[model samples]
Target: MFKINNLSVKFIILIILFASLIFGCTNNKINQIEDLRKNNNELNKTDTSSSPTKLTPKNTIIDLENTDSEERLLNNIFSSVAPSVVHINITKEMDVPSNQNIPDSFGFNFGIPDEPEQYFERGEGSGFVYDKEGHIVTNYHVVENAEVLEVSFIDGLTVKAKYIGGDPDSDLAVIKVLSDPSILYPVQLGNSDNTFIGQRAITIGNPFGQTWSLTAGVVSAVGRTMRSGNSAFSIPEMIQTDAAINPGNSGGPLLNSNGEVLGVNTMILSQSRSSSGVGFAVPVNIVKMVVPNIIANGTYIYPWLGVTLSNISLDIIDAMNLDLKQRGALIINVFDDSPAANSGLRDSQKNIEVSGGTITIGGDIVVSINETEVQTSDDVISYLVKYTQPKDTIVLKVLRDNTIIPIEVILDPRPGK
Candidate 1:
């Protein structure tokens, strides 16, 4: 109804065109947003099976493969050797003074004790099956004076055992059980002479009365000698290990990584009555030597050198005016009509006190026997026990009066054999 100018009409047409263009753009944007939301919903509803699924890389398999080999070896060794190990319990009868105070007729206080009372002392140790004939090998001290011997297996079965024979010099003893041969597992004896330091050493025994406990270590040394049992004799060719062996671990097998018996765990050097990382084992080679003789006879006959020898110490070197590096067994005394006496080996004329200690002087020093060097008294004993027999002739290298002389000696059976 209102009159309009040409310029005004043009302005109104411009505004309407601008509005239409803006509305069209806004509607296009809304449609695009709706399409985007629909696409998102379709993506959310899609099944995982419709496409290949992405998986995280698994590294556990590789980790397991890397660790399985060593673990398997240890497991297999333990499984194979544990069955041959046994627990030994011994009961000994001891006489102890009775605590009862014998009162006078008036019941007056008196400190006089009653007669000695008998009591039972019990000990525990370890052993291994030696053969299929039910022979169990253990330390002689374990069964020494044992009134009752009992052997227990890993399966909790126990039986009374009888002492077959024992050699106190080697601290080894054999006992027999009446078990069936099919149930026994004899240990495989290894060549202890071939053992080397740093090789894996494993021990299975009843440590602190815990049955069939396993410990692992490395062989610390070989060819060691230690005093065994109550005897003054020394067990030679001992294997030294850092394995944790305690009171009940004696006579158990010291096994190599291949599960072969290298030695018999005998004693530990410790002040705490526990394992202090220094444990000794009797070499299987020595065991092999003594066990055969024990089985053949009721006892093992030890080969003797018929001379009392002492290791050449610094005191001896100073007193005797010998070479500083001279290491050998010094002959203290030779038995009458013995091998050393008959072979012209001279004994020490006198004992002289030196700054270090008292040493025997003017003795024939045994440097070697049959080309084998004698570095210590133990070395001489070890060589004789391992190599020589009765009635065998051995050539001795004697160092006397600054001269090296070869003396031939014929060995004889040890006296009182």
Candidate 2:
């Protein structure tokens, strides 16, 4: 039994020694593999450092430097113009119909009569300082029927404002801020004529009651005509932009890249009543003509030709038996006892049916005014709005009876001036 135990112990010791030898060999192999990998990596690094071949990246990298600079530029513009912009809040008094006769299901009055309720409605818009004299320019609709006007600045300074005057024809109004002159910073107005499409447009206003918001876009178009809600005439030479103009953006400044006021943001064309990227502004040129007159007098008097004009159309040309290449403003009707009537300007004498519809014939086609060719009614209207004033004499070249004739007419103040 002693001899067998010694043999078993010897066998176990041999097994243990064999296992250790196998493990040691496996570990040495792993270490050698690791060393080879390390050497390979070192050789690659040395080659890369000494190599002259420039490795081009497989992925395209966009440089965001210009984008970063653009953001900074917009931020700078907002900072500089925020002080000049103002938030306008108006309280309008309205008469609500009294519910005096509260009728029961049996159709009999069940309540006593009460007086008409006076409702005070709150509204908000935007404007900018016009001059050091505290005159602030805004839309006419913003202050229309406003019983109380409150203006707020960037520093949260709220002050009462008195409506100096408003030209509903141009949809422009001026209100005198009842605040200290130190808080007023008048904005620089740019020439709307110089504003071109694709140029950067920036708008700073209180959109959706969020005071002093900024929106940036490009001028989509120029020389657009917008109809005034309170005037018979349309505001001409408007600037159209794609900036996100909402309800409270009306009367704000649509600025150029130079931080100059290109126009006053007036309206947006949207079915949702929110911004759909289409917006219009009353051009600064019109503001230039109308604002000073509003400050000097009680209103801005617009020049009137006292004739209803329409663009020359194919149907009208066919009906009037005119040349197909003819293009001008067609006088549809002349107002009685007005400038066009006093100067013997002819109107349509008869109606003739055409393929499209009926058109009036025998009216005078205005080919030119003041030596400038009139291709459309807009041309005539734009010319008068920009160049002529009330009582200014203008010569019109009219095509009548297959012959061109010159007529002199003195302009008069538009109705409701």
Candidate 3:
């Protein structure tokens, strides 16, 4: 300031302007804060009691005093069915691989055991009491080749079980435990045919070796077809659910909201070998049909036509010069000596390529079974399982050479039955 150059004078003026701007902004902020405080005071003084508005957000509101009825029902179901549910412990003999011959550094030979060593592989699954006679319903795979079976009840009572009968076609097995009648709570079997999609589905099982675990979901689908790993036949009228069924859940009861047994939890579709929410159960109707037969005999005899059937595809339709809307079960191959073969039912003789792949055509397309209209192979299988029995003569209305022809076939017991 004492020796004022032109630059020094400009710098002094800039400092004065910046100081004025800061003071002005400070004053304005103080006024705005005071106004906000006044508005808050006015709002607080207002009579909120007259309107009675909820201060909390609607989504965050909690009904602490009230209990959800569905939740209570779930709890009730678990309590009532826990006694009927059982933990099945399996002991299977596994062949341990023998080591190959190895030579030491000194060229000395070391020989492995001549016979492979065997060890017991322990596994567990779940089951439900089927009757007062101590018959426990479970999956056949659960007890397949099982050397020893031990069943544990909710009361911590463990008893040895003997496999009475098993049907691999239906994946159902009956194991009898000599337990007290008082401890055996047979689950009420529900009619799976009456089940509908979106109906509540519940499961009581031992998932991942954890016993008595309960899961809840809804029926994803009904009347589904699931291929059996134990047989060449497919299980029809299956119940599909989103229920979390894991490794140890096989053979457990898939229940309804009323605690009635709807199906037997059999398998799940997953990459991790655990529940990915796509689980399937053998319908109780199939259980009703198969279990009694298994108990009476060693196996359940399924009605077989011995024809490998395929759904009519677009390629097949085009190859056969059929309507685009044509739907039926196409006869792919008729096994020799089968009912279909003996009845003169024809198989596909021509091959045609489609967008997907090559397909066989010129086969007799099954349009109806026993006078019932069939749209696909599933209809035929379901009809066989539900209505026809082995040795029963049935008529199939088939589309052959653009003409419907009726063929009578006497059903035979499925192979390996």
Candidate 4:
């Protein structure tokens, strides 16, 4: 049994709570001191030049030596955005009324009460204000099934937060607190499309309910993918980083060097169950794509393709006798009345017997899209995601025996009705 004092637990919680925001900062507070110096005689001719009596005017220089290179970034980022972020303590009622129960005669001194008792389950995470009306953004799993949500700030203020919206697919959620908007420090949204790998990435949040914690790292990779929650839907275009993200760092902002928000830190892969070299961020591109609809409409819209696709391998290329592997997506199945079907993308007719029990044939194999090469299923999806939008035309270079066909396929949204 591990014994720890209350203050020790509190300190550990505090350190974990401010996961990424405490290190590598040099205190250089930025002050806009006007450079008040007269330009010899030319300054004396201005319309309202504060009575320029220039003899030999010297300038005052203030160099804050303790300021580190990143202090400016920290100040600008934390000052303008700290209020938007909040320390969240979620309490869940773990007791459930169920017939499954252990007998009191078991060799255990513990006994269950006749009535269902409340078990206070507590967890901590972070969130950011998403809207002027005090809407906050955080990870969905951070507050999963939590009965009570308490939000706090660095200034010793606290409020009860209300659940707004969540998409398990993206692992993101919105929360709101009834508070004064005038005192709220909202973060500015940046263009994630412009975010590049190797740029500085920063995170700020309440890790383990310790408020106003911040950390920084560089963008490790772009266009990465991950999956989250029970629905098991795929998340694409995620950002990978080497930042130190721990358990309670969920839903914190991953920032660029310019102090612009780039992503939201959501998960980590570690053997020790702490931050390893790999931390994953939900790119702000995906966040912006989903959050507004979630805020306004209480749901998210996803772009979909009607056909299932498979990656083309050298074996599949040889076995299928493909003309060229870099043609397009090999459609295994197509939905009825889909835009792909209407656009003449055919589906496999019946099950083709192979090593497997059933296989489909007859569907047209897609070769290429516009000028982009489609060597695999991922290639096809990436090509479509980059070049085509909903109800947009996609030129598919298809192979049909010895004859090649150029088909103009119009893309459609997912979840076809």
Highest-scoring model, lDDT:
3
Q: TM-scores for all candidates?
A: 0.78, 0.81, 0.82, 0.68
lDDT digits (tens) for residues 110-228 of candidate 4? 44566556567789998777777888888889887888998887677899988887877778888888988876777777888887889888888765555677777788888775667
Error of 4 at 230 (Å): 4.1
Candidates sorted by lDDT, best first: 3, 2, 1, 4
* Deviation from native of the Cα of residue 400 in model 3, angstroms: 0.3
Question: What's the residue-level lDDT of 59 in candidate 1?
Answer: 39
The residue pairs that clash in candidate 3, if any, are none
In terms of TM-score, the best-performing candidate is 3
**Candidate 3 lDDT, 200-219, residue by residue in tens:** 99999999888899999999
Candidate 4 is scored at a TM of 0.68
Residue 209 error, candidate 2, Å: 0.7
Q: Residues 1-417, candidate 2, lDDT per residue (tens digit)?
A: 456688899999999999999999999999999999999998777555567866668465544476777787887788788899999999999987666677788888876645547879999999999999999999999999899999999987999999999999888999998677887899998999999999999999999999999999999999887788777889888999998899999999999988999999999889999999999999998999899999999589888999888888888877778889999999999999899999999998788877777778788999999999999998988999999999999999999988999999999989876
Name the regions of candidate 3 deviating beyond 4 angstroms.
1-65, 97-116
Q: Give model 3's TM-score versus the native structure.
A: 0.82
Candidates' C-alpha lDDT: 0.89, 0.91, 0.92, 0.73
Where is model 4 more than 4 Å wrong at Cα? Answer: 1-64, 93-99, 102-120, 322-376, 379-417
lDDT score, candidate 1: 0.89
Mark the regions of model 2 whose C-alpha exceeds 4 Å error after superposition: 1-67, 97-115
Residue 140 in model 2: lDDT? 97
